[model samples]
Target chain A: MSEFFQQIINGLSLGSIYALIALGYTMVYGILKLINFAHGEVFMLGAYSGYFLASALGVERYSASGQSFPLGLALVVLLGAMALSALLGVTIEALAYRPVRSAPRLTPLITAIGASLFLQNAAVLLFTPNPRPYPPILREVRFTLGGVIVTNIKLAIFVVAIVLMIGLHQFVQRTWTGRAMRAVSMNMDAARLMGIDVNATIRATFAIGSALAAAGGILFGLDQITINPLMGVLTGLKAFVAAVLGGIGNIPGAVVGGLLIGLAEQLTAGYLSPDYRDAITFLILVVILVLKPEGLLGVVRQEKV
Target chain B: MTLVGRRWFCIAGAALLASFSACKKPGGGAAPGGSGSVTTNESSGLIVGHYASLTGNTAHFGQDTDKAVRMAVDDANASGGVLGKPVKLTTLDDRGDTAEAASAVTRLIDVEHVNALIGEVASSLSLAGGRIAQRRGIPMISPSSTNPKVTQVGDYIFRVCFIDPFQGKVMATFARNTLKLDEVAILKDVKNDYSIGLADTFKASFTALGGKIALEQSYSAGDTDFSAQVTAIKATKAQALYVPGYYSEVGAIARTARRLGLKVPLLGGDGWDAPELFSIGGDALNGSYYSNHFAPDGASPKGKAFMAAFKQKYGTEPTGLGMLGYDAAALLFDAVKRAGKLDGAAIRDALAQTKGFEGVAGTITMDKDRNPEKAAAILKIVDGKAKYEATVGP
Candidate 1:
């Protein structure tokens, strides 16, 4: 059915953003052995940074005046936002996570939650909780494929998400930093014994993960056209569910999990009842947890000792 | 490691304490209930309490309502204050949290010893704060919270705005008559009492008026994305979409609906009356229309004066919620003046007997149910502005 195709497109578009956000949670867990709860705030900061940077570069002014912003400028803003978000992610690592790193596993997790609440409130204090128009990067252009309608923003989100996922895959599989990350994930002390700077590796993982989340945030802003301080809370939790569903430490699993959650949410909203969208998403999680406690892609590894 | 954790915990504790102390509480100077300053037995000053969501999700409603109430206080003071006693308003921030709203009202009643209460531009919050006012035998007036059950707390609580059924029927009637739309889709919010109630009433009235609901959908309160709901609506051949949700999600919904090529204009209720609606919804919401208490395009002379004064002070156009706030506060003052004293029972009696009071929103008369029998405004969004289309009177 056309509605079925439309729902799939909707699901995939939403899922791509979820995938991007989930990748951050997955990588950080992989590297630090701690779920970075503040990663969602980092994504939120990414959206803000992009908005501020675009305004700084007169792109927002152009959009406000009903003029179309250049695509090249949009890309530049996206990269700039990602870079700023990376620096913020690194700062969060140093200030919030690092101090609590060696204390206990639970300590960093608690600190991450604290940092998340702090950042969420700080955003409200700074941005004033007013949902601002995410300055348009592209004029809304719609294309109907058969009976299903697709917007340029939706297509762009899907394309960029897939491209970024592939690039991350290649980078992780081929790069020396990836090897260092893997070594660190294998055993922190063992990685340090093997002359790998575990801290730097963890920071790099955070930076990459944060950059991915930034991309997600910008795309999400472009599609929604509304950005607010508290937008990250529910979204961050959903992405975390995606990461856990796909095996928290598994990269490809995060993307698949994101897509599945997105599809489940949309399909449920489209065909079933809209109210049950979240219920279904969580139900799938519970079912997945019950069946495969280790996650879809997660391996049951022996203790490193 | 334990020492390090303890040291970090101490630092975190110090930081938390520093922030709490450094943060200024909004209109919060009074001590606890049992404190020495608990009773305001002196009749020289009339203290009225107001609790509002001054800093959270619905802060716009709270802040705007507070502005109008403050202006009303100034007006009353200039015209020989309520019963010759200088009226002082003690406002407390609920932070848009229901628990905070209850505690704030508790503090106002027990600690400040206010004569009356005015506040909480949200229905759920007014419910939280109103229960305390009702139990404590204080008269409370909610500016814009329109849920029928808000006043059902007790006889002591009242609302200036038309209730949810009236708003829903007004929109349904306007849709059938003014817009000439036969089939409309309904997207309700399951978690919100206001949205769900309005949607149900609208559905009932629309069907009664020979209009069919082509589709029905529901979502939660704070959902940022409505792509799924909108896509589902797009599958239907509905002429219009009725979304009686708040502006925060409505704006995004409109954008998503428009982006997905759903050309039918969205219809909404009072929850769509925020400045952010224009900015976030933009050109996508141009053809949409919404129902409200006040529309600036066609205002009464009194309404025009209030609008001008409000614009002069706040530097922005006053929404219907602000107008409702002004009316609520002025009505309270008038009731107190008629009562000839700051006594709660006397003021409540006067408020119950209020009739033909000329308010900026409308000529309001308190009905038997402690609600103002008033007209609702239908405003169509045209080129980034809400233009008055028509008004449906009770």
Candidate 2:
């Protein structure tokens, strides 16, 4: 029973990060119908940026009197990561996607992949091509809930994720920009016909998605306390799976998909061979795509032949 | 004039082509060279190529190895250069992805036209990279890849690190004889050939020494929860658990095992040498034991010297990986000096002939398998530090 509950905690924590990253994928896909393959690289940049800022603050290197900002320091790192990641996302979209928007879909797809590789390699050149130990910020204290020992960090991640999801849901449902985004996603031509300023909406989608991914990246580093230049690859793949499973362009679908994938992975590791965890997650994704091509929550649109 | 779209088309074409060209300008390096290939030109200024897990999860090890290699190259160049020709090191990031490693290796051999290669701290990456060198007749020396299959890629592939057979035997011996364990279970990282090789060897050796193999399970590289594996192992009546994998997964496994009320003695190989293991496992791994190439707590004078130098350079006591890399670099330099040429084949012959070559790890002698036949030390975890236990024969 304890083991069962423990797995749930682990699943929820892992799911939260995936959900955060998936939001970026879903939002961008919703607006542009393009998978921002470089979005993962953007998350990688955020983690690396956080590492640099945190290291500069002397958090890890602190001995006796070195500069340390436990609370304010975390905030600064988070804000800096979001800012840098958002800027990178916007610049990449402008340089790589905006011009090719009208070109064949294959063109931008290949470009996004190329951009992803470029950013990944460039990061390796700029930073140490190594995993920097994420300086431990929050101390772990296990508390028993229903006989399950849960770490404070895991609980905090869950709470923070829930808050962020709620905040996002409200933003998309209540704001004027949200309606514009919906219109743009529904039909770019129609949105433009209605004076929706489609270009600006697309840019905003990229920015917001990148920011959320940055947050997820930061939280992931905080949880594991280790950051590597290529950490984003696996996480990105998993989040993409989540986004697709929940319906690529649906916001709520992304959240549901993230949690489902995370829980599935944890349960597999908890009950079966941990080696097959990722394999199983990917297999399920293939299965879902084959069975429900439109995704679990996605609306099936009829072709206007 | 409705010609505004044409301007956009030209701009997009130029930008897209620029990015594509940048990516395609450099292909992956060549295959591993054979013992008689003259692939490098010393007179033209040597290009030392390195293919490592430069951009992924295992990038930390590759980065540390790279730093040590650069340091060695700089030091060698400062000392009148290698044979009056300055050494230039070119690196390719494998991203800790296997396919990427093959491309990186190809580019290093074919495009960079490197004289000799040093790389791939991870056993899997090295195995993949080694094949490229072996197929191309290039000399590729791995600093710390411990999987036995790494050297089997070809005679051109060599590692300064001891193979899993020796390390695995050392761990098994420690568990059966030193820890007095009658029964043991093993958890290995399935995605990694190194972990699987080491675990298999340990199981074979442990079972041979009157110890029962209670249960053997597997996990991938990034798995965080181990409740089911632990639960299954708990029912097996095992007295010890052998987990051969990197520190990331091993630390999580250790903590999860403790939480499951299984206090058996845990054992592992050198992959548990990362500093993060201590932070993640904490009190969980207090009584665990692992076999490593070099123990930071070694009483040997050479070990002390290397530790001191490492501290001076990195401001932290070198992990076994760092020390192994330093030794590999120093050994490679020795072979290069003895071969008296920048030719890949000549240097490989020199490497094969190495005997009584002293290093921080120990005296490394390449066997016929192109693996270093040297002793490894057993480390016992005490208060988040790996303290020396006993040095066992190779």
lDDT over C-alpha atoms for residue B157 of model 2: 86
Write model 1 residue lDDT over A105-182, tens digit each, in one string.
Answer: 999999899889888977876788777788877677899999899988889999999999999999888999999998
Candidate 1 - CAPRI tier? medium
Candidate 2: tens digits of C-alpha lDDT, residues A156-196: 77887787788888888889888899999888999999999
Backbone clashes, each candidate: 0, 25
Segments in model 1 whose C-alpha atoms lie over 4 Å from true places: B1-41
Question: Using Cα atoms with residue i matched to residue i, what is each candidate's TM-score against the true structure?
Answer: 0.95, 0.77
* lDDT score at residue A26, model 2, on the 0-100 scale: 93
Using lDDT, give the best candidate's number: 1
Give the DockQ of candidate 1.
0.61
Q: On a 0 to 1 TM-score scale, where does candidate 2 land against the true structure?
A: 0.77
How do the candidates score on chain B by TM-score? 0.93, 0.88
Q: Tens digit of lDDT per residue, candidate 2, span B30-63?
A: 2233312444475555567876664456656776
